[model samples]
Target: MGYQAFYCCYKTDEVVSPEEACEMDLNIAGDRILELLQGDDDFFGLIDEHDTTLQFIRNGDLIWMEIPIPDQKGSFGKHIPIDEVGPLIAGLPSRIDLNDFSEMRFQSW
Candidate 1:
């Protein structure tokens, strides 16, 4: 199977349903997300067709990425430097697999 995913920005609700999410133009959402990083702990989430999820959590002054592990009902998280968000999102493709970011994750659940 090929990679497929949908996105949701808690503040904008840009993609609230599968029927319309359509691989959510990450380029646009990434930019929007970057701009949403205020002190509030807002969240941006990506859930693939397979039910795997990646959550971007905004903290006091930085961001953290949470990727779920379905098999163990656990998750892994990675701290994201505010300055590196642009480059990181820019390097991403429309579809992604968690395994590819193993080096950036640490067990969180």
Candidate 2:
């Protein structure tokens, strides 16, 4: 299954579950974050997937990511922490001019 990411304005103490937050149309927010971090046209390619982790490659750099999946209440299946994934991506050699990805929509969760 494909997944999306999102940035939320709610407080950390708000107690909202990841599944609920994701359902709130946060893909736009996630996409915006990606745009700011990478660029308007940068493409993120999916590389790996596990029960709780996903890996993506952009410009040949690996990006590790974790998502918290709520228990059966929704599609949430597992929990992966970004801290575990970020470093893996940071260690890769940086490259330039990724695939032509203009006008691509960012995924949100």
Which numbered prediction scores highest in TM-score against the true structure? 1
Worst 10 residues of 1 by lDDT: 1-10
Tell me model 2's lDDT, rounded to 2 decimals: 0.29
lDDT of residue 81 for candidate 1: 74
- The regions of model 2 sitting more than 4 angstroms off are 10-17, 21-30, 34-49, 53-109
Q: Which structure among the candidates has the greatest lDDT? A: 1
**Per-residue error at 56 for model 1, in Å?**
0.7
CA shift at 6, candidate 2, in angstroms? Answer: 4.0
State TM-scores per candidate: 0.66, 0.20
Clashing residue pairs found in predicted model 2: 4-108, 4-109, 5-108, 5-109, 66-80
Candidate 1 yields a Cα-based lDDT of 0.61
Candidate 2 lDDT, 7-58, residue by residue in tens: 3222232222234323222244334334323422222222212324222322
Clashes of each: 0, 5
